[model samples]
Target: MTVDPFAKGGLHQAEAILKAHGVDAYFRSMAARTGDSHAVIDGRKVMLAGSNDYLGLSTHPAVIEAAVNAARRLGTSAGGSRALSGTLDLHGELEERIAAFLGQEAAVVTTTGFQANLALSALLGRSDIAFLDARVHASLLEAARLGWGRVRRYRHLDTAHLRELLAAAPDDAGRLVVTDGMFSMDGDVADLRALRDAADDFGAKLIVDAAHDMGVLGNRGAGLAEHCEVEDGLDLITATFSKAFASIGGVLAGPAGNVHYLRSNARSILFSAALPPASAAAALAALTVVETEPERRTRTLDLAEGLHNGLRTLGFDTRPSTTPIVPVRFADLAAGGAFWAALFRAGVFTNLVAAPAIPGGGAMLRLTLTANHDETHLATVLEAFDTAGRRLGVPRGPDLPPVRLTRGDGRRAGRR
Candidate 1:
């Protein structure tokens, strides 16, 4: 592969790689979205099984009104970074509310979920060790490399491996055990209990990026840490508003001292423009709804659970996932692409997770559910997947785990 994107030599190789895997159904334009569960893609209305709008607050009347009011009053862009003149009353309001909701002593808002992790650079010392799960999000891995720290990986979901890695690190070194609260691809949650215990044993802090867990888990919709009853055991938590808040922004919450330090020292926050007023207002309103409407999260998980079981009964290898994010595995990338194409043709839309997105160079279909989805939608989607499975001759097998990328092999981190 060439080092340049515009170099002529790289063009054919890039096209050939994508074309060989039948990767044409992705990145299509969509118009006239009705709600969280339906959208018009390519001039056709389809059931959206690929969306992350778990609570369906994107279409909530209150959220829309708040955004409209904020945009009308403050204009669109923040106009500058938060360290300068971009900070608004709306930012403080949202930050305070989020901090309280997450049970953190303080919080700082960022422009995107990626930046939230990048902000960790301000806290990691050169003598620190960041122990990560092999399947942790790419943002965390990149942050560890770019920040002042040494990175080490353990087997995904294998607490024993994490403990071993921690035990082998320098005793006097600062340590941080990092993981995604709910994995975006596999849709399973980390064992927070195990993580907390391991970190405590090694005198390490716990950093959880609950991008997929916030507003969708726990009795109060806090996240996996709360759902697993380990919230008080963790040191830091980060989350995004894009998924359930129906807005765009990121938040980093922790002790008051750490948050204040990052707010002052993090390059990502100091250089990047603050989150727009409309986005912040929308997240604030969505948070209110998320607090009042617990049934939405319940409906989302119910739909996902039913869909997971239905796919399994149809002989598809859907990992036992209890979250709104469900993954259906396939024999290979070609099969996954063909199935995704077939589903689109059948008026269903889904996301494809192909190598090096996951290990073994195969593909996985990421099926998500939202509060707006109903039993009717779930039944229709299951039928489409069942039809596609029989038609493509994939996802039909005994349950098994895929072989994973070896430690420190960053290719499996998903460039896609």
Candidate 2:
């Protein structure tokens, strides 16, 4: 069918495409919540298995009290950009605490994770060559675009390919190699060790977006860099507070001078309002949770094991996931949508990933686990998956051996 170019049905066309592709997203409002375990969505208590709340501090008394107290003391908003009057005491304290937690010399908090990448890339990426992993977050890609850098994408988690690109790029140009410490969708940790080696060989500074790694990996949830023994190897580490920190902001942790440079040169930070008092305070409190609660990390891995093993035993193709996020593989969009819908009807909520998120035939259900999920919660999530799997007629276990879930840096070399 031929369609008009300037018609009044752009919205209709978009909706048609969504329907054609079986993208029926449910818009349920959540009213109450607690940790990674459970929440009240649409007035019904649903096990929240898909949150990045790795440490389950989202509803912790300390985090909640910190936010509440901060709002009471400083009001709701910062009202100005960080460059202006928005650089409040709370932001300063959070930055200091976060930097210390991540083993960095300094940190700068931004309005969101996207802003953190946008600002840092803008500052550090002059006429440099940026070698990014193919699956790196969109924020980093956007930042590269804004930074006006020579952007080259290496195969996802392929260190040798990245090395070739870095070697071929002009050595005289500033060099920044960016990757996600833990890939968001697939829930697989990056090959930071290999990436670091390549970066060092080529003299390219390494930047890790640890949004999924923070508060989930490492001895004290310091992130993939610390877990992979590359905390110092990386030149910069950026993460989002909205995930494990349970707040609405992002922070860039690295050398004090680089952060200072970002503060001065990054337009995103200069133009956007700083993170509000409540978010800053909550993030500060969350850092305490990360430091004190080692069991949260343990529980996170345990829960991940339960769900990963459960689904695998039921015969669904869950990809190699050592982290809390697992992608249940489907041959195409049809099966993915059917599985997603079945899971929803079975009273479990998971992120449905399809085209644009995955390769054309690589559609899958992205299941995210949290440390807060107890056996009961995980069982419920698995039961839903089993139901969905049966309906979709997808084969259960693979011919390959069972993938064991382990702790301490889920990186198996060349396994990506």
TM-score of each: 0.91, 0.91
Query: Which parts of model 2 are misplaced by more than 4 Å?
Result: 1-23, 34-36, 123-126, 409-416
State the local distance difference test value for candidate 2: 0.79
Candidate 1 lDDT tens digits, 284-359: 9999999999888778877876777777677776664546677888776667778888998899899977765676
Question: Which whole-number lDDT from 0 to 100 does residue 326 have in model 2?
Answer: 83
Best by lDDT: 1
> With candidate 2 superimposed using the best TM-score fit, by how many Å does residue 179's alpha carbon deviate from the native?
0.4
User: Pairing residues by index, what is the TM-score of model 1?
Assistant: 0.91
User: Which 10 consecutive residues of model 1 have the lowest summed lDDT?
Assistant: 407-416
lDDT of 2 by residue, 1-416 (tens): 88867786433443454478665644557898755567786676766656777777888899999999999999999989998888899888888888988999999999999999998557444568888899989899888877866789998888989988988887588888999988888877788888888888888888999998888887668988887888877788999999888888998889888888887888888899889999999999988988887787788787777777777777765676767788887765566667776776676777766655565444677877776678887888888876766666775656544565535644332332
Q: How high is the CA lDDT of each candidate model?
A: 0.83, 0.79
Model 1 bad stretches (over 4 Å): 1-23, 399-416
